[model samples]
Target chain A: MGDGPSNEKGAQIMSLFEVLTIIVPSTLLTAAPLIFTSLGGVFTERSGVVNIGLEGLMGVGAFTAAVSTLGLEHAGLGDASPWIAILFAAIAGGIFALIHAVVSITFRADQTVSGVALNFLAAGLTIFLVKMIYEGKGQTPYITHNIDKINIPLLSKIPVIGPIFFQQVTYTSYLAIFVSILVWYIIFKTPFGLRLRSVGEHPAAADTLGINVIRMRYIGVVLSGVFGGIGGAVYLVTITSNYNVSTIAGQGFLALAALVFGKWHPIGAMGASLFFGFAQALSITSQQIPYLDRLPSVIMLTAPYVLTLIVLTGFVGRAEAPKADGVPYIKGQR
Target chain B: MIKLVKKINWMTLLVPVISVILGLLCGAVIMLVIGYNPILAYQSIVESIFLQPYYTGETIRAMIPLVLAGLAVAFAFRTGLFNIGVEGQLMAGWLASVACAIVFGHLPRVILLPLSVLAGGAAGALWGYIPGLLKAKFKVHEVISTIMMNYIALYTTAYIIKNFLYTEGERTPTIPAAASLASPFLANLTQGSRLHWGFIVAIIAVVAMWFILWKTTKGYELRAVGFSPDASQYAGMNVSRNIILSLTISGIFAGLGGAMEGLGTYQYMTINSTFTGIGFNGIAVALLGLNTPIGVVLSGALFAGLQTGGLTMQSNAGVPVELIQIIIALIIFFVGSGYVIKWAMGRLTRKGHK
Candidate 1:
């Protein structure tokens, strides 16, 4: 009971609801970044553009958000102004997405390769800016607490579930969820959605239908960029609250998995993202449990990726991606 | 004639030139936004690393891994496989080479050096095969599987480094001078330069790969499979076997990269100390090279130059080394959308003819 492992074990085994209480909220919070990026990915893929640089775009968003958030605070707006940070992050993310759109839709470059380039460029640019400004201390000053967590008034009073699931979460998770719903509607319900999906499924056919594949893809990729930016900003403001190299870490890749495992469906991807988030939460939670606690930390870190692998192999059955997802559409292929 | 010349490969050169200029211009704009002297900074970047021979040698040291890693990815890319696992493969190669060097410290250089190099490559090949097997056998998606394998390789390598191999501060040892592939005579001939014969070896490897890729039956088979696996399978090519073979070849390239790092520079490998991300960077190398051996070498040099200059930019201009990573990411964006480029170029040439 005295040792760290024993106490950790005690915490791990306490009760079913206890695990859920800790897990549900953290999972949502963890899933928030993925949710935003997946929405971004879904946007592009549905419109027949595959944005692999969402990770890079997200990194850009995170770095810019951190700097601007800090800047805003210095300018006396205070760190509590997440609204301003989010706007700034959107611009940052948008800029990266615009670059992706130009190379991919306009230049007709390889979508996957372009995304990778964005990642490198963002990483280099962010690190350069951080170092040039912050002088290699590895990160920026932590965001003020006021700039972070906001508890809902009536929601907070709704018993155990409220505080655990709703109280502690950054507003980004809620925004991502709202956007996921909005994206679902936008991808499947509206006229723009139809054109986007049509372009994705068969660009030539869509072209015959008078749909502009390039324009749709550009919108899709740029939308992804916007969401990716929000994801990054949210990640920094809510989770890590400080900018560092490892701050973004492997979250981008995991989110990519979430997007894929969701089979490119907006709602389905939400479920997948939640699953990954829970896996991450469980990995941390297992630290307290005795039987699993004895396992190596490497095993713990490997768990989420392994789960992704399993999900990919299992549920990724017949993942009918957009026909033009990675294919650059030529006006006269025939 | 001028237009015809421009139509041939001029755009390939043109795009890169335009991209470089634009990328630099964007870089300058960002520098200004953040309040820095872009000209002085860029100048320092050009001078600080290139002007100094020692720095240039160190840059070459970095370029070795980039070149090999790029080859690994370039091999896979040409085979129609996107290998995200190069990072892990490279790490595995390092681990294997280090294990051989540490355990067989007394072996003569003539036999041991080659043996260690082979062992490193073999390890990476095995690691690389995991995804190939999964993709070929289980009908799994290669992209997801490769990414997962990367994690497995990284964690497995880290675990091995911690508990089994690199334990008790014995993770690194002073490599015997006998183990060095370089001669002191050659070192002196380079004017106190660390530019080892390894650079020469890398060049040779590139030329050899170019031969294998373009001048061999296996190369034809690989290219055919890459063109369309279903069609190749219909034509009696073993799709599964090719997938496995391509990955194995790719892994060998990565493994050799690790071996180079160990043999050429470190002379001994240390856990957690090998240049990480070089494998991932190899993908960038392949992209920049447009999936050719010569392209890989040139792109590797370009990247090497940027990486070298990036450090200087950090020290002098307050730019982050990670900015280079972002640039690489941007390049990947363009490369991934290669189809777009082909389309646009076609349109341009067609319009020109009209």
Candidate 2:
């Protein structure tokens, strides 16, 4: 494997085409989850609810998806377990997000504190469940079947785009891209989007127009949970193999960084997530690249986070949040 | 005299007390559901924390870092800056202290120990200052920047420890006795426990945090800025400077907390693949303490005891230590929703009077 290519394939070694083929698929898979979760962030923040509990919500989704898939497959549900698991994850995530909504929106608790509490609660609860089910172990059993890669017939025949984009693609990754455009339409084009933005920017004005501010915020937060849950499920089935305490490690936060770095727009967040995904892919593929192997791996490992910081500080041009973001809307308070 | 007693605003004290009861009750329900004996579990935790000398000392040892961390968080909270970066600051501080100890190993104990502590604080200040500077200059939210800072700190510290200072394993070389905070007398007094003089440092931190926030003009400025940046600006105060100053000071306290862990408890720094969770735990302590110096000390000790006792609960009650984490999380949830309790109580009192 290490030898220079002697044949046609060998000549393709370290070639730009070869590099793009390997890197593009890996980057898409890594960024898919981030795309979903950051889009979730966009929904919630755009409606003026700061949903930092995406981390916990993602955990709930991942754990639920894993356990449900395991149970369903055990019950002889053939070939359909993964889809069912995603459904379970979305429901679980939405349910878990209700805690954040009740505490932050209904009771007017500090959003960040509530989000932190949810994270702790999710971590403890999931591990506790793992122990109870697995007989003192901290992880679930790894399943054999996972989300499969598909090659589009005509698209896969294309010269350059076929190998890079069409082959070795998970349906979830395409779904993620499609959903990004869909969410952009829902957030920017539709009446619901208009009302949601109005509620976020000036709830009093929105309320004057008979728009229910509270309900809009709740919808925004709950949609975030749904998307974040799907993000977790996609990440578990496609990226990692099993459910454990570390399964959803920091992806939620990274997604949030992408959200802010992308200036909270759906397309922008998708772009930023792809950028982060590429950085992550580099960390894994650095050993394969002759030039990259010479550089210290630490730089690649830390690059995504540092880049997020730099992006926020440097090019966050008018990345404005909702005017009433993080503020509890009282009935008559100014 | 009767009116004075009635005007004491009983809710101020009652809120926390009631929240604790609610949290414990919820924890008990979880225990019962898991088929564990809730009474036995609680008993084991209490016994392990109080009845054993070694465990008692360990609890105190644990409380040293926790106390400083809580103070760090509470200090930031009081200044209206939510510092989610304490964990990163602590990591930075820990690495800096170990580096200082190793580099200045030839110095006398008096100079080396204090120098390492200062180095830790300085490193932490630098970490905290980034988010503060970002917020003050670029209008970046501290929460996002600080969270990013934490990931940076975690990987960077691990890389440094692995490549530069690794001694025997994934840890740095143990500091010499001259630079160590371990007290032979204290260890002997606690029956060979790992207790050290960091307790003294924790106390000093609490007092200093209290004094700095209450007695100084700088404290007043910070509080004013916290209360309302626009108002403080209108009053001719440097709101931006105060914001940066508060976060920097908070970082110092957290960094010193890391120093206690290095110089006092472990005498060496080990690389952590994940966050130590001390910083997040500090948030719980700060919230439970109501963001006051004395309150943080008391709450920090309480959490320390719970953590120390969690092990006994695991061994004695046949339960997982994760249960304690659930209880702690529940406690924070209850505390965060204190307004709900307050509103209910006010309604109850009014209905009773009517």
Candidate 3:
């Protein structure tokens, strides 16, 4: 009878260890892309331009990263190929986002409509290029050089914290977390951030202040593209390793959800992404866990979205977007 | 000539025309850059749709869902709501219709068929109602909520199909013929294509959308609310109810679109790992159609024809079918950015006057 209690305690400890080593690392890995993408969302929304095209932007990034990585690897660039591909992905995303910027900002088209078009363009253009490059194949060839997980040298020597946070974790995850802090500092601490916020909150006022509202909005949107591109590239390198129609399926939207759930704050976005990523990781790894395997897989799959809905319903709290978000900034117009 | 142009509402007609031309030109440029003969590809798409009776029928059949989906989107847009969940609602309808047909296989054809279709509409309405209700009661953004509902519908349907309705092919068993919308006469008329009675249903929906928005007091209220909710509320309109009603009506149209596929085109639902793209296409259709009833039909026909003909372009000219999607996207872009086109047209008219 006494031995039974000890054995039960031992099992509980083992599961705890498994969760830290397995689930925690995977959750961070999964959340890294969302963190990056939602941070991008934060920038655009803070600047008062609603970017529903983040999903498509991420798709462009994924495609660019996959294709460039494949080419670079073939050219014998070895381990450095994935990193270079990330740069190309960011550039491609920025260029693609320029279309949205011009249409929504310059032409003053409906932002939502323009974003939808951006998505369609990204999907079609990427798949068309994929087929053309791969000799009519619908997907890209698997990339050989993937972004592997690494251990922080001395930090990884710590017992529980090291295993959960430092060991066998993608550097991209750390980069994403670091970027979140940086974004926080930039958006909250800097004059540029204030100007971007002013443009979003009240473009007419910003214009009155001679802040160049349109220019600030443009920078905000393009920065989203850059971060979104990096998010997609990191996701491809770490998780998928190939570009297909469904590869970046809903991550961009999830990031958008994260942005909303995070209330458009950088650190909040990171936290929300981690939570959503935990839901995704749970679904993916549920089959291995003893009790969770009995739960329906659909529950896990739908958890992030359902939670977002609940959050939006103000059960948790209200999320108010920038006042001028999605509205075209007309000079001298209130 | 200036008087005639002014009287003709020329800008409305000119914008879509110029957009289409620009879209096609952009598509051609893409093909040229890729070292393909754009002329041959274009010719092939044209020939296939015109020369082949089967392709023409298939295109019309495809238009049924596209038209309904467009109406769904246009309807919501008229009410100042974006129903991005049409895809999800459609999925729910597709499954519900198929499941109803399968479960009620014993009912007479007359009763079963309409019931199955109505079941689909109701299912879709329920899916849409969640977002509408949330938006009405909690001030949640319809776009975000609808987007979330889509993933929920997708996962839930997939799970239900796998658990309860699994067949050998990872799909529901074929729905009963009693609940089918397949029309043998229409199929024979179209050279054995899968044309069905759903075309009639689609036509009715188009007329319904037009009549509701233009003729009904409720629709006036919805449109009023869309234009300015504060003014409408001040004018004694129930803005919240109108918002909910608009989305539910939108859901009905989207549901009918799904039923067209379930009853007429496929006769069953399959597990979809991703969106069917029809819902997103509906947004494109509604936008290009200028959110008008008549415009939707014409744009829907155009899109359906392009999709049907795209296969022939692939086979005949060795160009990928996704090029058509690119063209459609360009068309949407041009339409969204109509200001540039209008400005250019204004400059052209001024030069002509000089």
User: Which predicted model would earn the best lDDT?
Assistant: 3
Interface RMSD, candidates in the order listed: 3.0, 1.0, 0.9
Taking every candidate in turn, the Cα RMSD to the unseen true structure, in Å, is: 4.6, 2.8, 1.6
User: Each model's DockQ?
Assistant: 0.47, 0.75, 0.83
- Rank list by TM-score: 3, 2, 1
- Model 1 lDDT at residue B337: 53
What's the lDDT for residue B85 in model 2?
91
lDDT of 3 at A147: 92
What is the TM-score (0 to 1) of candidate 3?
A: 0.98
lDDT of 1 by residue, A1-334 (tens): 3599987777666655565666777787788888887878888888887776777778887887788888888788865566688788988788778987887777776666766677767766676667677766677788674345667678877887786777766666777788888888988899999998998889899999888878887888888888889888888777887777767766677677778778889987787788877777766777764465687767766766776666655554655566667887879995
Top of the candidates by TM-score: 3
Report lDDT (CA) for all predictions.
0.75, 0.87, 0.92
Error of 3 at B174 (Å): 0.8
Off by over 4 Å in 3: B1-8
Q: What is the Å distance of residue A208 in model 1 from its true position?
A: 2.5
lDDT of 3: 0.92
lDDT of 2 at A64: 85
lDDT of 3 at A177: 94
| Each prediction's TM-score versus the true structure | 0.85, 0.96, 0.98
